[model samples]
Target chain A: MISFFKKDFLVHWRDRKEIIISLISPLVIIAVIGIALPGWVENPTKTLQIKVALVNADDEQAAMQEFRDSLAARSLPDDELLDIEQQLEQLSPIRMLKQVFQAEHVKEIVSMEELGNDDALQQLQEERIAAVVTIPDGFTLAALNKMVWNDGEGTALRIIAEKASLQVGVLNDIIDGYVQKLNVQSAFHHLLGADAGAAAIASDDYSGIGGREMVDGVETVTSFQYYALAISIVFALLLSVTMASKAITEKRERTFQRILLTGSQPFHYLMGKMSAAFCLSILQLSIIILISHFALNIFPGRSLLFWLGVSAVLVLLSLCVGALVVLFTALVFRLHDETANGIAFIFSLIAGTIGGSFVPIYILPDWLRSAGEWTPNGLSLAVLLQWIQTETVADLSVPLVKLAVFAIATIGLASWCFPRRGRI
Target chain B: MLEAMELRKVFKGRTAVDDVSLFLDQGESVGLLGPNGAGKSTTISMISSLLTPNSGDVRLNGVSIVSKPQFIRQVLGVVPQEIALYEELSAYENLKFFGSIYRLKGKQLEAKIQELLEMVGLRDRQKELIKTYSGGMKRRINIAAALLHDPQIVIMDEPTVGIDPQSRNHILETVRLLNREKGTTVLYTSHYMEEVEQLCSRVYIMDHGRIIASGTTEELRRILSGEDTLLLKLDKPNKDLANVLRSLAPIRHVEETDNGLKLIIAKHSSLLSQIVQTAESHQVEIINIHVHTPSLEDVFLHLTGRTLRD
Candidate 1:
């Protein structure tokens, strides 16, 4: 295994053109994109504001009264009825929705105004608003029933938009976040009982909806830092493809067959390719980070702890990238076609695009951003950014575990796909 | 000894090697002779355990290596038809890598690499990448890479193809040394009859996925012992003369050569005089005439109606 690793490393090192290209391409892209689009990176939300019309069709008083009457009809005890009524007043879904939009950070991005349904539609068509948030009639009654009693189908918040745009996407994300929080609140209520569930919702962590925490008093990421990290991750992912392409050459030249004939285990050969990719990825990431920091001050005035955090993320990301290399290598050997390289390249491109390596996850729709977080590169990028802001070590645990799992799963799949004795 | 029994291989429903059987005794230098698509590489692959036959078994000594490929792999060194060494790596690096995989390490591996470099006459250029070397130089390094482990059996598939005469000679001498001095069993495959004749004690001739004939050089030559080849060099080509010669009762086959006509006839036939007279009657001048004993080339032509190269 060590011999295979050394050979693969030497082979990659000796290819001067490929090595130079791999090291320089990311820096060039970072420079171009970072310089050309400063606004998108430096202040992503500075010039962007989502205008929304909040049309409240439900009467809070009438819904509370209707809820009380329904409880009376069910013949609940007086103490239980009072307890249910108090919980309803405290956890009104409409009030929660309004509070989310009213948050300071949420207010900075979304400007909401109360308007009638006809007026809201007219303004929306006239491009006066990005979307219209409608609170339907009986929403509070239905939501209270579902949350407190686990009865009846829950009412959904209706969002009407003129078209799908960045502003509309952000607005939809904000609403989606609120709904998810509500569902969690409801689950806690059922699992932990009413008082514990209410206490959980009243906790400081859940106080602000769509609000940003100023960790360690650090400012938000600049365009240069964002692109430097994003492009670095994208190129790091590309290293897997590069390694697999080299494997193709070995296969074509019959060098791989020669190695096999030496009685070397196939697993060792795959691990060798993977180790080379892992080393290359770390090298590429380190070089890019150091150069960008020294030359461009991408991570200006960062502490030792910050650098250590970056290193940890780099190692985990490299492991995932290495595992990806073996998967691509296995596919290259199994398919035995020219398109194997193309397939790997396409996969990297798609992963980079969706994983927020090409674009910031904040700008993506809620669903897409969630998916991007699941991707190795995307997860790493998010964690690294968080590390930059918070300088906190505790946050790395979940993402690191996820990255390790990704590595293990990919390596397992690669082993399954790799050709065995007779197949080779 | 290494033996392949009734080996057969098919790719995408097309038979590649069909019921081929051959064996190599310990310390013997045997040749597998065939044309480009005669299944030589496939047969070599199966024997080396790099490829499994559809329905056949290869054995090392008395064990069936088909079910236990490692048995053969341990003792086998395969020099593939293609240059399998890493082009980006130097000759020394390639040798070191291959040697290390076989569990050779430390000073022993370094010395083995040095010895191989000297044997292939590339010691001075060991630091240069294989991509910078000439075709012959690359082929020499390729051969050196296979010998690093000092396996008991070496299977070479057209090792001398597309190489300079000097490198070809060097490779052949290396094989001879391994077989004669080192007592390594060899299975060398090539379409060049002379190389086989010079290096191998026995040869197996294959065509269309099957061995057409196999025997010692002298024994294969005896297939046409009753026949002799007649060469008539004329000033120019004359199809009419060839036809006229073919019609003769003594001549069995007549073929037109570039500068003359060749005839196969009974041994010790007195047809030279009659052939010269016939050329004279046709008003074509006979440049030269010679009677030659049959060779392996003639034997292949006699059996397959085509030259060995074809």
Candidate 2:
């Protein structure tokens, strides 16, 4: 084993062409995305209300006052209330609100001449406005039945809103939702009953199932911690494929056979290349781990076990991948001429993606994830995540055993595929 | 000493190496001469234990290498046709890796590396990447790599296939010198007739997975002595003249050559009289005639009726 490891160490330390395959890409990816774009909170919540800039074009005061009174009556949470207050002080669109809150949604009012050539809607969204509500000019009588709390006034208030933007459509949703809520409150108070406050008090005792936490009745994972973990794992898989491809290329070039001629056993040759792969993988995962903590600031080493568990899986995954790669490399070397490297590359990539290296299982459709879980790549990723999250080795009992099974099974398969040839 | 007893290897549906056997005594040099796909490499691979013969035994110094390949592996060094040194490492580094495998290490390994580098005439450029070296240099280092362990027998498989003539000569001379001075037993394989004729004490000519002939170079050539050779060149070619010449007494052989025809006759005999009469009758002009002894190529041609590669 010392002899084998020495061989591996010499090859890796001396060979730059093969070294880059195992090192550069993963580090660069970590540096560019994980480090450069640090603090990417993957699962952002809409619970914190955003403030928007509003501009009103109303010529009347009575309708504006009534709209303001209706909007103020909304029993919003403290954050949303503060956001709304800040936005109104900035936009003052309520001074231009056309009706009392009867309609489900209200449009924003703006003089085209006053609005510059800038992206006003984008400005609203970025400034935390839910949406821009623009109301057209009209007499209060024209909307007596359509309006929520319309007491006939001088002229219709034209409200100019700046809230919802296109990407994620979050800000616009908040503004539209608040508009509807205030409209209903206005209707109850102005149209049917004078006991709108009492009605709200009675109906406020409303709670429902956790829709956001459970997406479509499945346990939803909102944290990007899982996504980062998944990407790094795939990167690790790609690293294995690269290492495997080199092994195949070397064999084809007769380097491995030449080593054998030097009194090196088949196992020594196999384990040497694998040890090189395993070491490089450990280095790669270390860099990725450091990226998550120092750069992304996500998934900090929760405890010693979390780190240890990740390291252990990485080692196992590297070995499994190395075994699989060598088997393919050996198979290609024994069978094909000049095309072995290409075959290994295509095979490793196929295996990597099948193992969920590119797209995470959670992001993939349910059918894809279910079918993909059996593949070595997918199982490796799942096993890793389970191992990382669990507190003890006992909790990882099944996954560790399954990983061992995968390693042994792949080695067996590779052994079958790479049957010794060119000799009697 | 290296020995192969009835070595044979069969591939998918073909017998790549058929019942073949040869032996090399300590300090003695031998050659395997054959065409492409003629089982020379297969034989070498078996002897080197890179391959396991289907039914045979290779013994290094009387130890059964078939059951225990490690013995042959340890006692043998191989110079494969392809330049198998790692392109990524310097020539020194490549040799270091190979040397360490044979249990050479530290100061001893470094000293051997330096000594071998000087032996191959590349001591100054040892640190350069193997990839950057020219073909001849790589071949020299390839040979140097084999010498790293100083094994009892060194097997070379067409080691100078594509090197320059100067490098080829230099490598052959180095092999000859090593064998002469150090008594390094060598099993040199090549299709190049002249190389084996110059360097080997005995030659084995293989064809269609079988050794057609194996003996001392001169001894092998002596088989064709029964048929004396004759050469004839004519101004006007006549097909009938050759048959007429063959009927003459004291003449043993007649064959075509590039310039004209050749005739082989028995020792202390002359057939020019009958040949001149026959050629004159056939209206053929005789140009020149001469007799020469056989060569390794001739021995191969006499046995297999073709050159090594053909």
Using TM-score as the measure, the top candidate is: 1
Mind giving the per-residue lDDT tens digits that candidate 2 earns over A119-168?
54566546544434444444332342233334443233233344323321
- CAPRI grade of model 2: acceptable
- The sequence of per-residue lDDT tens digits that candidate 1 reaches over residues A205-310 is 4334454444457668888888888889988898888888888878887888998888888899999988888998999999997898888888877789889888
Tens digits of lDDT, candidate 2, B151-222: 788999899988798888779988998889888999899988889988999988898899888998887888
Model 2 residue runs over 4 Å out of place are: A9-231, A247-255, A288-312, A329-347, A383-401, A408-424, B59-63, B226-293
Q: What's the lDDT for candidate 2?
A: 0.65
TM-score of chain B of each: 0.95, 0.85
Clashing pairs counted in every model: 0, 34
Docking class of 1: medium
Give the per-residue Cα lDDT of candidate 2 at A203: 43
